[model samples]
Target: MSRALALVFTASFGAMWSFYLLLSVVPRYATSHGAGGIGAGGMTGALMGATVAAELAVPRLVGRFGYRSVLAVGLVLLGLPALALRAATSLPAIAGICVIRGMGLAVLFVAGSALVPAIAPPARRAAALGVYGLVVGVPAVIALPLGLWLAERVGYAIVFVLAGGAALGGLAALPGVPTRTRAHAGAEAGRGVVAALRSPALAWPSAVFSLSAMAAGAVVTFLPLAVARGSGGLAASALFAQAASTAGARWWAGHHGDRHGSAGLLLPAVLLAAVGLSALTLVGRPIAVVLGMLVLGAGFGVAQNASLALMFEHAPPRDYDAVSAVWNIAYDTGLALGGAGFGVLAARTGYPAAFGVAGALVAAALVPAWRDRAWLRPVPDAPHCPRGYR
Candidate 1:
């Protein structure tokens, strides 16, 4: 990996670390403070809602200010706001912090993904992205669980201080990232996200990725509630397994995509996810739940990498920011919608049947994935792009 790319990874790591640290902590904190179930839902809903909105707008800002500037500003917004959370106990105050942090997350995802293709060589671009995914995923694997533990052992105030500081510390890495973007023939990147969505090549992958993302949302959001009453620990373990699998598989998928093509992986990804969902039918069985999660995570990993790499392959470098925004919109919105939808489905049909239906939805993505099968074929034996496409 290049120095610049590595630096971006570092910044992303810190940003994600801070974000994960509060993922579970925030909702519980809100509930304890009198935000009832609906209020807590609003708390997360508001954060993700703002995050999706900002994800769309961030690409435009990247085109104007460059990646480092946008990213630095994001880190500041994400970090500085948390410092204030130490004193704010009301829902409105908490919501405000979530909104600011949500915007920061939007900036980090858009700017960072945009910067990746610009810095990494075309030949290994997918692999580089996988590594990047690993770097960022580490936080979710660690801080997510650690955050709650720290809060319980020490206190929420200390957790708040550390979380904010971790995010703020990422700013130091910003000065090292490049100010310019990868050059392209047209101004497509500046053409707005809606226009990008108009491309069938781009939209298809986004759709497929969204299906899998929805499942990811369901697993994390409802798996705990779906299991036995005292299975909170089991749910956490399963979630961790899924997250770890996704991370490892992402890198492997990128590496495999470089050697073969990403399109071929699409059908398999959906199928794997379906199998994983099928295993969830046996959710009452702890081992079955873990196994299903692992399989599903692997599928999700492949889908994530393939969709991203294929989108990048088709689009000119100029469109990277827009591409990033579009893919992330799929990610955040899918997660939000999946969690919301699955909740309703579970209430009506029960967890086991709901999971089966969720799998069916993911399987349905295969039709669109099939259409892109031929598109992802890499040039034989002679893999890797010759050089940077300036």
Candidate 2:
């Protein structure tokens, strides 16, 4: 990797560490401090809602302020708020802090994702993104489970402090990264969110990806509580399995899609996610829970890489920011909806049954995925670019 890409990856590592370390812990924190499932889920919803809100504006921010300034501000916003979380006991206070952190996460993701393809060669674009996915995934694999383990032993305050410090520490890498790339320097760059949303080429892949993202959101937010009590170790192990598989699958998918065309993978990816979610309906079985998460993670990983690669193939370099914005919006909005909506649904239906319903909902996305596949199919005799080229 080049120096600039490595720096971006380094910054991303810290940001994701901070975000994932507290992802499940914060919601559990809300519940422990006199809140119900809805409150816990609302914490996630508030965070992701703020993320989507910021995603809508991040391209403009990057355009105006350039990447270095925006990224530095993002790290500060993400890290500083968690330092106060140790003292904030009320649900409202916790939710408020999450909102600020979410905005910071938005800037980090939007700017970083846009920069990857801009920095790398087009032929290797998906592979570069695969490396990026692996970088981000490592934090989720380690910190997601470790936070809960640490909270159980050392207490939430320590975890919160660690989370805050991780993000703040990423500031050291900024000097190596450029303020803006040539792709982002033009006046016409980063202004196509609405236009991208309007076009079917972008919309179909986004819709397919959103389905898996919603399932992932629900899994990460509520999986610990969904399993039988005293299964904290099981929850941690299961999450580790999920994150590990996701990282591996994302890398494999990127390379495979680059060679074979990403469109063909979307249908199978959605179906795999549906099957995995359905298995979660049997929460009493430990083997089933672990296996289910593994499968779900694989599907989620493939969908994540394939959909993103396909979208970038459809658009030019100048629209990378807008494309990243649209993709991130779909992802975060799906998370918010799943976190909040599943809490309400789970409250009434119970967790196992709720998993079944969620599976069915994911399966409903197959129609769109199939449509996207048909639309994105490449002509057989056309000059070969990448497999995903029109």
lDDT of each: 0.79, 0.87
Candidate 2 residue lDDT tens string, 1-390 = 899999999999999999999999999999999989888899999999999999988888888898999999999999999999999999899999999999999999889999998898777888888898899999989999999889888899999999999999999999898888988766775556888788676788788888888888898899988988899998898889888888888888888877787777776887888888889999889999999999998998898888888788777787888889889888898888889889998999999999999999889867755644664655444332354453
> How far does residue 102 in candidate 2 sit from its true spot (Å)?
0.7
> What are the RMSD figures for all models against the true structure?
3.4, 1.9
Relative to the unseen true structure, what is the C-alpha lDDT of residue 241 in candidate 1, on a scale of 0 to 100? Answer: 80
Q: What would the TM-scores of all predictions be?
A: 0.88, 0.96
In model 2, the worst 10-residue window by lDDT is 379-388
Identify the leading candidate in terms of lDDT. 2
